[model samples]
Target: MSGLYRDVGVVLRTYKLRESDRIVVIHTKENGKIRAVAKGVRKTRSKFGARLEPMSHVRLLLYRGRELDIVSQAEAVEPLSPMLSSLDRASQGLAALEAVDQLSLEREPDPRAHAMLVGVLRTIAAKPSPLNVPAFYWKLLAHEGLRPQLDACVRCGDSEPSARLVAFDLVEGGVLCRSCRSGQAISEPALELLRDILGGRLQSALDREESPVTHEVAALATRALEHQIERRLRAVAMFERG
Candidate 1:
């Protein structure tokens, strides 16, 4: 591999290196997820300083190396300064970035995931709503093959509108009907909204305001994702703290 130039990408995470350098993980439209070293980025006067911050979108000229690529130059595509100014929104944005970092593999291109991340970041930067952030999580998890079945009961596949009990089984990947809810716990309203979310009804779900159903859905989605990933995100704890 030789030197290559790529268009802008969103910085997902960054770690300080020796002296004045850092390693950055970014999701690019052209190259998927990439890990590269941003030389001298930590220096006070470094031109790349702002461009390498997490959540900052940047265009890069890279030099492919044996172990990792080197970020030769970077230009900020979106500053995202206002978004990072809010601690709450920043926490959520970091969590989302961490989730993407955990879920994506090196060098593998996932256009859907890329687009979703970009969209989620934009939403956070513009509005910073907890509701939208959680919904974005649910959607991302679903796109990565962890979608919970909410339309019909997981056990019986029954499609009724009046089922009071809606049990979600992490191992089962969906909800269980009333008849099958023998030893299960569930929130009916949450399950119903989850069904709608899985069915691409975001506007309706968001229109419900600050309903308990939304919280339940967010909780359920978080639990389901943790179960699948086998690790709780550090950012979740920070988000809760704030």
Candidate 2:
């Protein structure tokens, strides 16, 4: 299999290699995450110069190499121009890309992960919301089977409709009831927003504008994602500072 193969993927990140070549990390629909060298891509007239940029959804032809795969041909399925039009959109979009890069494993075939990445990018391009990136993070965590329990306490099996849930434990992976109150303090509105995010009411949550509740949700989601990835995302930090 040391020859040409084709795949569709989203460019997760890229780095400089030599004088004119670049290393691209892509999350593909079939082969999962791959690192490939785009030869001479930094040159002015390189065919794949623009096609291989981070956040681009691309279809590629690659030649298997002893070490890094070589990108032979690339075509853009979805360019990231729309999402990069503004600081707000770009920041959120880039943060999501970093999340995908962190969560994806090399050579692991995860079609669902690929689908989710493309879906979120398309959503951000069409309608950039404050909730979009955080929602993506939460959903990604859920897809990875680390979904935080929202219906009841993480400690006790309290499912009463009026059971007091006051805080979220990022380490424990769920909400804490009044008796087991710890971690980030969760307001009633914030808790409801979390439910809407994980409980099949995503559109409703996305339509709403930014507020204290959204901020709380974003913070919790960011912390949880950082915990899962075991490192800080540069894009998320920059977006927050900006």
| The candidate that achieves the highest lDDT relative to the unseen native structure | 2
Question: Candidate 1, residues 2-25: lDDT per residue as tens digits?
Answer: 477665688998898899989989
**Against the true structure, candidate 1 has what lDDT?**
0.77
lDDT of 2 by residue, 9-82 (tens): 99888999989999999999999999999999999999886888888889999988788899999998967689
Q: Which ten residues in a row have the lowest lDDT in candidate 2?
A: 155-164
For each of the candidates, give the backbone clash count: 0, 0
Please report the TM-score between candidate 1 and the true structure: 0.91
Q: lDDT values of the candidates? A: 0.77, 0.89
Model 1 scores worst on lDDT over the 10 consecutive residues at: 182-191
What TM-score does each of the candidates earn?
Answer: 0.91, 0.96
